[model samples]
Target chain A: MSEHKNHISTYKSQILVLLTLIMLTVLTVVITSVHLGPFNTAAAMLIASVKAAIVLLYFMHLKFDEKIYRFMVTLVLAIYAVVIIITFFDYLYR
Target chain B: MTGNTSTHRLPSYLEYQGKYTGILGWILSTDHKRIALLYLYSQLFFFLAGLVMGIFMKLELIAPGQQIMGPQAYNALFTVHGLTMIFLFIIPGLAASFGNFMIPIMIGAKDVAFPKLNLFSWYLFIAGAVIILIGIFSGDGPPDTGWTFYAPYSLKTNTNVVLSVFGAFVLGFSSILTGLNFIVTIHRMRAPGMGFFRMPLFIWSLYGTAWIQLLATPVVGITFLMVVADRMLDIGFFDPAKGGDPVLYQHLFWIYSHPAVYIMILPAMGAITEIIVTFSRRTVFGYKAIAMSSLAIAFVGYLVWGHHMFTSGMSETARLVFSFLTFLVAIPSAIKVFNWTATMYKGSISLEPPFWWAMAFIFIFMIGGLTGLILGSVSTDVHVHDTVFVVAHFHYIVFGGAGIAFFAALHYWYPKMFGKMYSKKIANWGLIGLFVGFNTTYMPMFFLGFMGMPRRYYDYLPQFADLNLLSTVGSWIMAASLIVVIVNLLRARKGTPEEMDDPWGGRTLEWKIESPPSLENFEEIPVIDSEPYELKSK
Candidate 1:
């Protein structure tokens, strides 16, 4: 393992990330309030996914982690995506 | 190897102390092993509680006219039976107890990535168990809304649905935390050179199971929260009048609940894979294929939840697509089954108790999975929805598939866990008794269901009396056999000699260590320069 102190992210960057997440959550709530027809739900989820990704990548340290961890995360997300797509298609086409 | 090394000598459970050293040590300890044992003890308690409920259910069905309990009592009995068995017994029985105990050891780690979180999960599990048990005794009665806790009935039921759903919510958190811990442990804590493919199939299955637990569990958490809101706050998520769709409740429920089946069975499949390879003295046929198929099943399992919603007014096209995906999910399951059997094809095979249970799991699960195909078909599912066939199908999968696999794993690893040898003669008899009793109890339900007998009924028509009687009789035999197996294993615990390392000539890393392994598992993690089941070289 490399020197732990050197590898750790700075406090300022952490604070910036936290602020961005807070801003995104606020934006999500505000956007939900605006009537965007069917697009409203989709928009909220999209924004939520982005915020979640940010937390997972930075706060959870997936960005700094090994490639295998990234692979595992990616694989699980890919599978989740497949499930949602297939279920949505079945629901819609039917 | 140092022949005179003190560590070479085996350590008994009493002498084995890594973190906790005494009786109080176990009760309040946070060590993963102690937590696992705590889970084992509590799961046994829940298993027996569910068993008693099952016996009462059978007794009520025996005489046809509510002989043992009232209609309300009967409903509560079956409902608690389902809830306890699913939430308390089946879900945690294999994964939490054995998974917690074995995963770290199997991966050659000192402990789980989150030992404190493991203990916290156990506490949460016990808390949830107590809440559900409180509901059972409250006299207002247990939740009669079924294990699914489906709405309208769940919200409208006079029984303590709030406590039950809340208990389920807490249990879901316990499950989620366990999943999160396992994922991180598997990802980050594997011993120095243990690569993804080098990990045991059990770890692979758990990795898959943890994902299901993380992704799918939250949905059920939200669903149960919605149920609580409906019941307590009257928020009307499932209220047809309040513009909420009851069908939406099911869609949300099975979204987690269906993959929840995979959560229960996938680890059992992993355990069976390990047992089959060990007993047969062969590498698992298509190791990579079996491992990949595990991930495939977990992925596809999520899409097929709609198969459960087919008869609930889902569109026919949706049903058709779901039916196809459900069948596709079976392909990977079939691949696993084929790989296991082919591993056993020409290799040395033992008829040990674990092997017998594995064989039985295969036979029973084959029937269960095939019948599941019949149910997955929308048209046939419509006929059998809520019938005893659905009950029989799932019992075969859950009880036969997961339940028997758990027993098999217990038998296979008992020597390692307790460092003593159970009587194989008794085990053989116990195995036969269980197999016979299991079939006798469940096989008739298929016919009863085919004859249009609906499930969850307190009192059935007289036409169903004879088969019910036979089923009840079989349950008694099963209970006796199960008791005998536990006794036989416990009997070996006092003063018996410690078992040999590689007692079964297994090729896995776990067997490479001493029985009742030391606190740190390995003094030096062995470099994995060979295949997982390379028996010939050994």
Candidate 2:
């Protein structure tokens, strides 16, 4: 448990992560304005995922947590993804 | 152990005066035992409220035409009944009461990882209940939207949907917090050598349920917020005229609502596993299989929510996919049912009230589970979409499965929690009435539904009169038995404190402690050395 404390992010690193997230948000908005057709939604979601990844790693400290937390998150996200795909089955066919 | 011997036996949790005195002590204090009791009292209050509403609804349908109340009154009765039962009573029912009481102790810990958060969730629960009361009473009329609060009508209704939707949102938060607290506590607070597999099956059930609560509750919380916004803020979330897709609301609603069923039943199933293993005086067969199946149900439960929306103009492709997935979730449940039956195959079996309730759970849950398959089939569901059949199926599962298991576990742990033993004879009599009357009240609904009788109608055809009258009589017997059970338990609570630490000869860590355990559960944190349910050798 003491070893986990050593892995904590420094203030400067935390600031850098925050700045990167803000930059990604700006990029997402700018890309949405360009209208990449179907790819616009994909691009926004992709960039949003990157920003969320940064936040989850740095701010939430999942990076410093145990392997079990990572496994649980991945399992949850997988289920959510499957539900979305199944829901889209209706939209696509109808 | 001698180092702390004097402080250990000085006061049980009930007698130990915390920082505050009397009611504030319970309300403000963070003691898990007292908090569990708080939940028990409030849940009982709401359960009776829900039960009375159900009886009224049944009475209205007794003779078929204008019995006691108007159709509008019947609508309010069922709406409040559904809300009170699902949100107020059963959803948080077993988990809030027994889960809080047993989880930390079974894990060999002093309290949950976040004791303050546990107490706070209780407050949130109370706040949610208060908001719901305001929603029903202060409005122009009671929310007639049913507990589902299905859209277009929900938004368009003059009744106070806003307060009720917000109340559900708050209750969802309370549930999420409870789940989050359990997950962290189970991960971080297990005693010295208590491995995950070595922990009791009840904890494993809680682990699975906690995941569902954490992951799935947020969707319904957001969905409720959207409904409130659509009603109040003109956001057009589920309003079809405002370009909002109503089916989307159901998809979002069922996404959480379906797994929420697992959240309700998993702990009950887990409790039945504990009771069966204890009464049979044997090691649990297929421990990993039963534990893993809980996770499987929770996992597959998410995929199967689409079955509920099958007749709502969903695509044939999605409907077929959902039906298949619904059947898939049953495999894991069947695995548990089979495992429990096999555990009692060659063991020494004891006949107690808890054992009887557990057996009833198995029998009725089988009926419930089998009927679920019927509802899951797209073609069959099209025939009986909102009929009394769907109502009967879920009552068997939620009421028979979860509700009866709750009573079984309650009686099994009564001696432990309150340090008194209820009369075996009276309890058995009560069980007889409950079993007989329960079947009588609900079994006819399947036939009525097969006869094409739709549900939620205050006035029914004269053809349905005889069965409806029989159902009302059955409900009276059921209500009387419930009162008998409650009075029997109350009588037991007034007796002397039980001396047997392991009254039932059980092997769980909780059974190793004194009845009505002390404020800090253990004098010394126990070292884990053997299996959770190892029987004592004669």
Candidate 3:
């Protein structure tokens, strides 16, 4: 029940995060054009994951929030990862 | 305690008038108890609707030659029945009604963390139900793709699948919000000294159910939207001709639905635990075991969705892995079942109506759980896939496990909820009919299914006619008993409220309050200092 003080990002940090997101977006499109063979989907998903993390940490303020929030998010993502890996069992074998 | 003393007693939630009067007061009130009642009445309405549809489907199969309706009508009947029962009735059934009513009081809090959001969730539930009904009546015909809405046929069917799918998507939102609200309430609103371990087992089950509801529902929500898009916008999500893999659709669908089974039953197990502990007048035997088992079930439940797709063209490796996971999931459930039985081992047991319902739940759940193993194994499941055996197995779990547990909760909490005591004798009689008739109806389906009778058919072969006829008669008996149960409860509302606050001598925090608890639940918030179910004899 301890309410942590709200954290506001400085303008410079916000601008930097936005630029990084833009660069990742450009890199995603450029990488898709390069055709990494079996790694194409993997490369795109990895970039998307990084961008999502950045947005969550800065815009969603997970970095400033209590550690429990971050732990919960990681738990959810881990479960999702397991589900996806289980789904790939079919594709990989078939 | 005397600081806020008044000459008159506080008004119970039912008697309190608010900004609006009459039904408006009920619908608009942010009271958790009123919202729970809203869910209770609405669930009953939908349950009866689904019950009638089931009887009609049974009647159609009475003689095995289209006794009541043709194939198409039969299809529509079962589809709507499945939609209504699964989405509108049982999925949100116990948790929304009893959870909303009891959670705050049980935790020694005034209300949930988000009371307004709780009421809004109910609105979303009704809105979703209305949209599903619109899909039924206003369409070219009711969606005949079955409740599963399997692809290819779902896409090709002339019936309105989009509206129904969209309706389910909306319902998913309601489910998610309810889950989110419950999670936050449990995390933030416990009374002082009420640690997670000290909280009631019912709350623990709800915590597990909320996590499942929040995490698993969105997968199905997005899947439903994709189905709608496939039907309306021709996006080819599940359409094979358009290069979409129908099996992928099944994957996404079962990813949520398999966990959805836990969502339906975990609260049920929790309620039974409370009832058993109260009636037995003993501390629960394996408190942490039961609590941890609930989370275990929720976690393991996610990995077993592939069992449903065993025959749906999944690879051998995936099928084996899923089958193994399915069997693995049963260990935690068995842990819960064992814990409940051991709790009553050497205690002062009261054979109350609620206890009877709980006993029936265990008996039926054992059958359902054992048979689930049969269905979980890929070999046996391939034999009974889409057969009546699968139907019988799930009915025992969902209907017998969750549905009967709902009745048990109603009976256990009736005096505390409505401030009136129904006749225990009549309730037991109703249970007799329900137990006997429910078994009669579904038990034969297992034999019929093992004998190769498929489900959702308007008519069956001559060999299946006799058992089908018996099952139809069982439905009639069940319907009659439901009438008795409903009438008995309704009649009791006219009687005087019980003088004792704790009619059953229960030990939970809810029993410490006045019957039909006052608005805001507590005049002075209680500071918890003991265990949830510590009996005096102990």
Candidate 4:
């Protein structure tokens, strides 16, 4: 009810976002075909994250929505990051 | 007129029994209080089922070799026991039952934000339980893998791992929905003047627990599905022969499970805080510290899952880091315990059943927590990793902390929840018997584990037999005590002669409402005008 008017994104914005997501997906597939070895996963994740940010901001409307929603997403990502790091701590070190 | 009104009150939640009719009214009801009672009835059944399994297991242990059940049967019983207790009883224990009942009332809401979703969660829980039961009958054999259902054997065994694990996964969904409902309810539903800090410590703890239930459960849910995938499909997710590491399964399982421990205990801790402050006639000491500590515990709990895997062939550095994190998580827990003690100091106190249980909680919880240090250390855990010590330690914390605290909440809120009063004298005797019985059953296991008796074994050497017998005897006493407690409460279900609001002189918003609460939980939403837990000295 705290309104800036639940901003509905325009169709142009939606189409542009969709195109960008498709381009990123193709780019990730092309990149993975080449062995960047250690950087392969890192690069893919980075690009995929950009795609996620675009989707979250535009499609999910976290961009125009309240700041709290954005903070929650970041916090969730942080928890998953921690889980991955701890798991790899055992695998890589061992 | 007062007598007539009292007698003709239309049976607050229990007897009026909503719109539907008979059992349909209960299972189909959207009333949060009715849904809560539905949970109570169902959970009590599962609780007794788990208890019976314990008695049977203890009987089998009374004399070394199999007495009443076969070795395979023993495995099934204990496995079912763990599943029933963890999933069916404790995980949803306080939160689903008392949380559903109290949260909306405490927050001055009509009902939970999503009442239909709450009913759906209960139905999901029952459906999950039924699936697990079906797994027992339909499987090549009963699920013999312990509740952990650790990989390799879990996948290798013919016992219905897929269906049972599916059951557990379904239960996790139920837990997540309840958690989601509580979080939204708390955020959106508080009375006009109530701020976050102005809310009771119980609400803060429930807030912490909801986050855990929402976030942590998904990992276990995914893990179980991976198990199902590996079992049904040719997925080599956990089978080493199929090119997967079983350790990964463990890492995934404990990642959720370790935090899930708090999912059970944090709410119990909150209830303890509420009861202690109410009866002691004191404002809670370190209220912010206790509130923040719940969050700290939930946050830190996730990091220490590796401690459970220290001896699982994890790297030395991983072990060391997890060991450190394990110890780190304990600090917030210790802070809450200390704050509870400080709140009771130099305060006028009433020794109610809840208080008695809370005191015993601190004692048993201390034993459980201190022993956790032994398990937390990289070197010490290697010695007692799968021994009876771990069992005793777990039972102490889970059963003592959550289980006894459950009784504390039951006794503290009894008159309010049911609008009736039971015999406090009988409650005390039951408490004494339960306390003595509980410690007797589990204390020897610390020695048995130290003496090198491995857990999940159907038989033991002659040396461990005597202690096992003593533990079995303790089980009997505990069982008798539980009957007395349950019977006493059941008998008091009839409406009481006395008026019941603020019976414990509680300062929480729930205390301001009528006993048994209205269908909407409030005639009109109350305005919170003061801080939670303020009590006048008697």
Misplaced by over 4 Å in model 3 are: A33-39, B1-8
Interface RMSD of each: 2.2, 0.6, 0.5, 0.6
Question: Could you give candidate 1's per-residue lDDT for residues B202-294 as a string of tens digits?
Answer: 999999999999999988999999998987798898998997778778888998999999999999999999999989987889999999999
Q: What would the per-residue lDDT of candidate 4 be over residues B1-538, giving only the tens digit for each residue?
A: 0010122343567666556899898888999999998998898899999999999999999987778988899999899999999999999988999999999888888899999999999999999999999998895877999999998889889898899999999999999999999999999888888799887889899999999999999999999999999988969999778879999999999999999999999999999999889888889999999999999998999899998887788888899989999999889999999999999999899887878978988898999999999999988999999999999999999998898888888888888888889888999999999999999999999999999999998899999988999999999999999999989889888545578867787777777667877677665677666677755412
**Of 2 and 3, the candidate ranking higher by DockQ:** 3
Off by over 4 Å in 1: A1-40, A47-94, B1-7, B10-13, B17-21
- Give residue B478's lDDT in candidate 2 (0 to 100): 85
DockQ of each: 0.41, 0.77, 0.90, 0.83
Give the Cα-based TM-score of candidate 3 against the true structure: 0.97
Residue B81, model 3, lDDT: 95
Candidate 4 positional error at B77, Å: 1.2
Give lDDT tens digits, candidate 2, residues B242-335.
Answer: 7788999899999999999999999999999999999998999999999899889988998999999988888989998999989998899999
Residue pair clashes in candidate 2 = none
> Against the true structure, candidate 2 has what lDDT?
0.88
Question: lDDT by residue for model 3 over B1-538, one digit each (tens)?
Answer: 1122223558999999889999899999999999999999999999999999999898888896868789999999999999999999999978999999999989989999999999999999999999999998896978998898888788889998988998999999999999999999999998887899989999999999999999999999999988888887998988778878999989999999999999999999999999999998889999999999999999999999998998999999999999999999989999999999899999899998999989999999999999999999999999999999999999999998999999999999999898899999999999999999999999999999999999888878999989988998999998899889988998999998776478887888888778888988888777766776877522
Better of 1 and 2 by DockQ: 2
User: Scored by Cα lDDT, where does model 1 land?
Assistant: 0.84
Winner on lDDT between 1 and 2 is 2
Tell me what TM-score chain B of candidate 4 gets against the true chain B.
0.97
Error of 3 at B35 (Å): 0.5
Candidate 4's clash total is 0
Which digits, one per residue and each the tens of the lDDT, describe model 4 over residues A30-65?
998898775687688889889988988898888988
Error of 2 at B332 (Å): 1.0
